[model samples]
Target: MKNFILALIVGLLVSACSIQRSAITGDKRAYGYSWEQEKQIGKEADEQIKQHFGVYDNVALQQYVNKIGQEMLAVSHMQREDTPATYKDTEFFFRLLDSPVVNAFALPGGYIYVTRGLLSHLDNEAQLAVVLGHEIGHVAARHASQRAFIQQMSQIALVGGAIAGQHFLGIPGGDLLGIGGMAAQVIFLSYSREDERESDRLGVEYASMQRYKSAEGAQFFVSLERMSAQSGQSIPNWQSTHPDPAERATSIPELAEEWRAIGYEQTIVNTDQYMGMLNNMIYGDNPREGFTRSGTYYHPEMKFQFSYPEGWHVINQRSLVAVVNNDQNAVSIMTLDNESAGAEASVNVFLNQDGITTTGKSGITNRGLQAFQAEATGQTQDGVALKFYLYSIEYDGMIYRFINYTTVDNYGTYGPRFKEITSGFRQLTDSGILNIQPVRLQAVKTTRSGTFRSFLPANLENLVINVTPEDIAIMNQVGLDERIESGTWIKIPR
Candidate 1:
């Protein structure tokens, strides 16, 4: 467990500044994480990043990425090492991972990451440069630093509420937690409309300066919006707090117009070459470890896996595990299934819910012991028809919900996914899949005949490659300068 210095400081600052405000609210300005305190906060953020995704390691990829990124930075006003300014000595980094999700982010001291999912969708190098440029702007602008300072402000506000013992801190997500408890969370999520808009402007300006066509970059974001509409959902963390779709759609055109008015020309650099590079790049979902084999589901992380009936699709997220059933006409949502107290109490509490209306109940010991099943149906508060059989089991002192939906079909033919998903609910076991480790990105040097393998370890063969000489020559001139070498490092998803 890493020490959370900002959280600790939040604890300390509240003590000194207990002055109550006219009305309680959670705001970071009340407390302070001065420039002097930034180092500690950065340290904490580093630990958090490591815990979240493990540094995307690919040396060759990092070098190529850093070169392109620094090229963009050359035109940025952020301080360089010699000028004696705020961002001097800042080192930028990149993580290469095959996540299939379009996401990229920057940490306080120039740490940046781009998921392979987004990389695959990009139409060209200029688009890629724009994405990197926008993230670089975040680092240069010190927006995160500003947010951290806001956290301090929130802390002070929290303190005022504690002293007065009042509810509602007048801040976002303000509740009876006295603000002190949820202050950091609030600030982290306080992505005001202004922040996103600013990022868009910065991205466009940076791309324009790099001589990379800014409109091509804008087109990628537009594509993402189209994808979201086709899927009937927006991205998670990437979009949850982003400006509304209409607001977001308007931003890029405005930036493009600004660039055009200033005489910036549009350019497309090697769109086909870019697409060719992704020909064999693992498409859709990764199937090496746990994936939907036919219609079954498997996960190595939880150590237990199960299979569903035929034809049902699965949507796996970081937090929730869900599967839809076609034949049974239902969907199942798998969660931690945690209760306020503990596992045993949770089962009892669920069973005792009002209007449960149990039909046939029985006890079963599928994996081990202490498990029960009940059939019940009721209308959820949203007026959606609900029907299912819930099975509660205690595994590792945790209660798990294995629900089978057979009653309501809100999503219609597609709704069967819910039932197929819940039906596949079962315990995981130690199997061949559990033995495989996820691959990481590693950068390597390529010879005149250099291949991707020289950089990848034996264990990462599932993700290694052999680079071609012609490919190296092209990238050298157009993208990350391809200095031919007998041995060098490049990035690859592990």
Candidate 2:
């Protein structure tokens, strides 16, 4: 018994020693995940991420982001001389998400993602490097591992394993509470404030080492501030998932100055080069995928058309589309049903799910498509009573389903609108609409000096998708009336 106790004590000591302090934060942590476990989790989450948000689908752009990321990663603590051999061999992946949401995040084991929405706002390559470097810092400092350790201590599931399955793992089938579905949200949970700050400092450090003008990165925060104000958000996103934009604007410049004082004087802006790359890039939402015009939603590739209730907000995600009412009281989501069965069978499968009670028989659509419509009642996870209006339609060999819901009391007011939208589905046969290409940012040079607004097209609203002269001004980092020098290049969507 004495010998066995001695052996156990030695094993525990070895295990404890394996948990090392962070190189950047100096925080001692006994990470819940082994190096292999961390890699495995990230790999699994990465697969789901690709299915959810999709890869951006531009090879040159992908290569450009990876090139900058790998350069910064070489200088990060993950590749430092003192880094453990176990960590040194870990490969880092930098992916550009096709999403238009202005967001960036890192997964536990060296996977980083940035949305095109965030990329479009950046003025130069230096800013992009800083953003990539910040994500790299998260991996280098092992923030996710530390968070996982705390989650384990609290006995809270990091993310339930059941979330890996279909049917949104338990979320009501039609809600947009978790956009890009729930699995994407699991990998993108906000980082701690301290972790964000540490990553900020590391971002500045890595960008400076690369001879980039790190202060240029702070300008992106100005855009974020403008976006928050315009959207009427109570708190800016930076404050929630990242350090406050105002705070970062101050700190990043200060760090950049310090790096300059240390003799790294070749701070390159490379503005023109970056602007050249932005030429012909998709400026905002890619309307080719799906877009709403005059209360109608059109998917060019799918060649389908539908209409939602007037004045409702439309959220088009990679996997599904959601139409939400003004009062946040009702949501109607359209998504593809995985089952290959006919419309009636698909509706039967959905209604048969646990906790949902069907109240009516399925009916066919009068618009030529074979459709199944049913009314049902179900309770939310919070036990709130909800009235559901579901429709499954057969279109082009695929089963498309709409799950529309509202409170039991409000269903009468919302039901007709739901019925209108579900019945509105039809094959889109408009050639001009079908061939509508997404607006691409075209580089143009001024023939003569004038205010930035002078160069804008007369029918700017028609040319661009939901863009204004003011938006173009902000995108170019100038005032709308700011005078442009002759021969200077600027970007405009075409």
Candidate 3:
């Protein structure tokens, strides 16, 4: 198959380059997809990207992501001026965030953010290209704008807007007003099965054209499915945006068949290199951005800390953090709202994201507090179901507690974990936590080290380097024919 595709595509390479030359394409794709539409949609969706996940800042990581992104654009059908690529005019930005959410998101202006969690999961550059291209397809197809346009087209936006303005005065501009605790409920309200499937197909084709085997790219999703089942958590972001994994699983193999018939090969999964990039890339969460430690939650900037039950898992995403107990029953998170005068204003800002009512003398308390709970009566779009409890409690001018979610239809596999985490929420004591700075690898020379093994103690502690067979190879290049040196600056493993 590889030999056949290699020979056959020799002639059609240029033809594939002009895939966007025609205004009308095929039923094989979502009709009326144009460059202009993609840009318009990207404009709106970009706002959502900012509102949801802010830009991730890291220089070396960003440069590499853009280089790959540019290569993808050179091979894709997104450059027609009238049908200008979604980010043609914009500078493409890519960076790794210090997050464990395992996500990759694209903003309107070619702003792309990939989490270290997701980076740790990918195998190679080709696989990364496929995922990045799929996101580009979303921008190209105007999915985000289409969804928002459709939302406005329907009465949902109006009713949602009125509800948003009336109760949640602390609502910010643009969409996603109450996004934190309402993810599971509001997700399916966006795209359809057909739209996502089309994106998948096109994504593969784009990858194929770029000479990055789409087959391996498809495997990332497969690996994710297995990882999610093993972790018993909801299928992370790989399949989160696009649901129906079992069916999608079948589709990828089918597409592989299509590419096989037309000549597509698979890329190798380089787990070693992948993990190396993740090493010291900042694990779990950045404590600086408000995460809890020990039995207490602290926000040094927000100037407060909350206590939690022991043995609970804590999650700290930007804007909020929550602790769940072992029973899959309760959770406590945090938020900040400065709109309502005094406590009422803060509480109003916190509840505004979900259209919750913040009226009539809302007071601050500890145990019994203001919160919202959502029950998933049936299955979610991805078929791995969940239920969620969301709310905010405050102390000393700071408001905290968003939601703790659990799996329901899926036999509560992730549910028990969720409960244990949420149940840990409590008030803070006067005790403070000591800070420790994490050591990261710099592109500096080997300041002091006898050997790779000696530098890495038995316990490893803050040591991030992994003497992989490849690193050993690079080490050989040191001070010989090239500038590679003892500490000639390379990324260390997480």
Candidate 4:
């Protein structure tokens, strides 16, 4: 009875809030957050995203994307002559994230991001314009706000039903209240198919108005289709948040034709300039960051190596490296403590954290490096007890921290494995491993007419990670058997 009453009060309070006008449609609608609140949310989330993905370290590339984004934004509904005064001058921020995942997305406000992986797959500036415009459409249309509003309304009904069931039918509402709060945080990450279709139309419109070859966007979708098929994860349009890539590939050209018929005359595909920008761009995973070989993980740039347990899964990121046991119950993580002056200081910082109880502490030495070892007990946010084996080593004027943890019940089974992995850390000195460099995309001009496959070196796959002739063909938006003319520019991984 109390829960039901509380839910009713919450719903009524939400219903009483003022509605806002959409930036695109200019129609008053109920949104979960005001425009100002949406901006603040995006501002805060943008910081987290920068820290997580690390911005791509290319000022020229970033400025080029921003320049294109600004051009598209000018033609968008948010900046049109008839747009509301409140939205007319809204600032849009475009960022290039240093990730190898082919993805692009927009936040609730005007924050947009594209990965270098996506940039590498693009063929021309017009395609990039369409992509940025698509993300801009999402922001201009307030799709995130609409999705949040719908999510909140659904949560209200769910909460009301759960409370009613508990009060009348004596059914337990297992953590239903907590789910709403968690779901709200990630609501902007995805959108409905209708929202996607609307953005696609708006994308073509904006790019076409800019005199770009908006139909070029269709080739990018074709590459996406090939990628999906190669990854073996193709799904029906009904099960996807966005329309099928093949469908989009066919529709994008038609959308461009519609704009052309109405006097847009979209014809601006700067292929040479776009290809020049991609010259020597990082292609796939950078082994200089960290890479696993055999049972050891090596960091060529940091000049360190560590042995992980055999058969354990290893994940290397910019900030840390994680090794997980097969059953997924235990994990060992290594991170650089840039703020700490010494090994003991790093371990002390960990021990001083709230809710962390140090059970044991001792001095240790590994590979002639000064180190500190400690055992601690802590409870996760979910109240599950964990046993931690912490090790910190000072080497080359830097502190490297290894944090290994498992459930208290499973500590006995995994404690030795954790210790062995951490103890194996040592300076990386092999000349071959230290000199390894990341593969980069190289622009090559064909000297003789031949099929695309014949242009590639036989050992192309050996030089690049997870790359094949077909993959290179897809990157160039060509078929493997497609003929190439002499003096034509093509990208090859080198």
Candidate 5:
């Protein structure tokens, strides 16, 4: 019995040691996720990510970005011969997410993502390399695993309050926690400020080692700062999960100078190559998925239209579309349920859910669409009381559900608005709205020297890209008053 007890203790110690040493940064006090476990976690999270935000649908651009990412990874920390076999064997995936939100991030086990929004903002290839390297650094340093371990150790319950915290942190699945449950939020958890700083450091190191002019990466941060200021946001959504852009812009150039001091003379900054790649890139939101115009939500592919409450905020995610009142005391969500054969079946499913108390008669909507409406009260898993008006309508061969909910106390005030929106749903038949294309960036050469604003075409705002001279200045990495030399190439939205 004594010998068996000793053996058990020895095995436990070995396991703990393995977990500590698994960190790619060689920190023995790091998290408990083994390389294999990290990979598994990333794999599962990657699927959820793909489901929530699809891959950007450009094959050639995807390949081009992947080629650059592959080159960077070959020189990253994980690619070293001294890296642990488990970690070294893990394959890194670079994906361009189809989101208009400018952002770049990574998941555990070598999964890295950059949004097309982020790509469109980049000024040069070296900046792109630095961004990719920063995300890779997060994966290599086991930051997400560390965060998961911290969450586990802290036993942070991902309830409504926690979901709100995640939302304010700018991670995905903020409002989605209530819709799809907590699984979606888990995969998109944010990193700590320290983790972001370390990744930034790693980014400079890796990009500089690859002989890229890493200082050019600072221009992206400048754009971020300008964007935040323009939006009147104290911190941009992307920076909420990462670090302060102003701080990053200040420090990145200094870090680049240090890297250059190591005797690397021929650093490459392929600005023309990068700008040419982004010449026709989509600038802002893609209307193909869904878009709002004159307070109405239109889905071109789904061929449906609905009016949301005026002044309400809307979040259009891939999995769902949601609108919440300015007070945030009420929310209206739209989703599809293909499994339900008809409207009555969809209503029945909602009524059958646990804790739901159906309080009104369910019947057809006023428009003669196969539909039913029900007033229901329910409690979330956290036991928060909720009042809901659920509308299930069968439209275009699918069951479309409109769930409007509020706290029990606020239901009376929000009920009329909810009813108005739910009743406003109908099939769309407008060809012009359906065929509208997204705004794209057009690279044009300067005909004569002038201020940046002078080069902008008169109908810039009327086009899909709604931006100002200040925005154009930031994109071109020049001042608004800076004179443009003749024949200089610049990007203008068209």
Candidate 6:
């Protein structure tokens, strides 16, 4: 998220004189950044995105998505004959993020990303084409640049922090310590309703040109609608911005029909191929990164464990884990200091920051690990006074820093809770917790024709956390009572 912070700051610092013609309509329009500047911004943001949400590790799946994206691009406005020369040859980058959120989005330039969670919900390649085409439409239409033109830069910054707080800390304006940047930008990049509708039209047009069954795209929206209704909230990264999944479910087919009337023969629906690609794919949360149980957090991969106060929320990402208080005023963060050689060296970096005044510093030991502890007071960028209790532990040749902080006025109330959590940090030793594996999609062929529910294992809950027959049905794009033919491949969590 720090990269997101830098991206926002860099965006704010850009010159405002830049303007450019629309890539899709060829009409002269005002833009926040020149076309060349957009490319540079996207290149910088792309690096941060990869770091924030690690690329999905499957090489074959990555190539498959890229191939589809390139095909969609060929038919998009960016590649059309009327497109300006400056944009006609813009290279597009399509990436599958390892995150489990159902989302697909485009950066200001030609950077596009789809999450593994979205892939898990898709039933066919044509649906994927439409999703990729939808994102490509955003880039082709210069939606982000247009938004930047109409929005106040300061408002965008506030929106970034608000999204980070809400998503990570479960509070609308909670200040998440270290995990606030690029990921927040993802939610911050949500388009207007008009932009979304335009993207939908462009998506159908591009997918239709490629002869995909563009109408199949509607089914994915149906899945999204069901997911939203079941969760009682919009799906993260997607529905948050692209609202009205149920409404889109109706319009998508109408758009496809419009294309058919124009002589586009949409017929492709590579279900088997898509299903084959999904076999053995990871589903739900990847617990190897970290998981919480009975108030203790454990990282099997990192081989560490810690305890947070009961009722505090935990947001665990590939880079770090943040624990937030119920009131969202206090936060404790844990992250690696890869560059620092030892605990004391890491502590120095924290103490040297501007506006920070150290009140106490000492060498200490925690759970048999060498560590340095420090107490400091400082004011935030917004001039909010705060107190900090920091720790840097050296264990197995790596420095793990725990940053605990709260508003100066509330420090007395939450200070003990912070100390208790950091002091509880220890090496993970339980064999069962260390060996837990992530649930994965198992592509199973039905032995006999039956309702989709009948094909699921009786111990469905045991196979995956918080999953149900209805959830699996929605994932397979079928109904719980729908009869599934024998020998047909369907995904089951295992």
Per-prediction tally of clashes: 60, 0, 33, 0, 0, 2
The ten-residue window of minimal lDDT in model 3 covers 162-171
**RMSD, model 1, all Cα superposed?**
12.9
Residues 101-122, model 1: lDDT tens digits: 5677765556666766676556
Candidate 2 structure quality by residue, lDDT tens digits, 1-494: 99998777555544533376666655566775666776777888788778667898788888888998998999888888887777789999999988766778788778999887677778788999999999898888777777766655554544433221323314533234333332443453447999888889999999999899999888887777666666667232354656767788889999999999998774687777777766777778887889988999999989999988888988787788888788768888888987648888878887999999999966686468899989999987878899999889999989998888888999999999999888899999999889988887777767899999998878776863888877777666667898999988788777
Off by over 4 Å in 5: 1-18, 22-27, 158-188, 235-237, 240-243, 365-368
Better of 2 and 5 by lDDT: 2
Against the true structure, candidate 5 reaches a TM-score of 0.88
lDDT (CA) per prediction? 0.53, 0.78, 0.49, 0.82, 0.77, 0.84
lDDT of 6 at 411: 94
What lDDT score goes with residue 204 in model 3?
72
> What's model 3's lDDT at 168?
15
Candidate order by lDDT, highest to lowest? Answer: 6, 4, 2, 5, 1, 3
Clashes of 3: 33
Best model number under lDDT: 6
Q: What lDDT does model 4 reach?
A: 0.82
lDDT of 5 by residue, 90-199 (tens): 89899988887787878778888888888877878999999999989888888766775666555443322333343411222445533334334344567788988988
Alpha carbon deviation, residue 42, candidate 1 (Å): 4.6
Tens-place lDDT per residue, model 3, 136-188, is 66655545444544443332422222111222112221222334322211223
Q: Note the residue pairs that clash in candidate 6.
A: 1-181, 4-182
Per-model TM-score versus the true fold = 0.51, 0.85, 0.54, 0.88, 0.88, 0.92
Against the correct fold, how does model 4 do in TM-score?
0.88
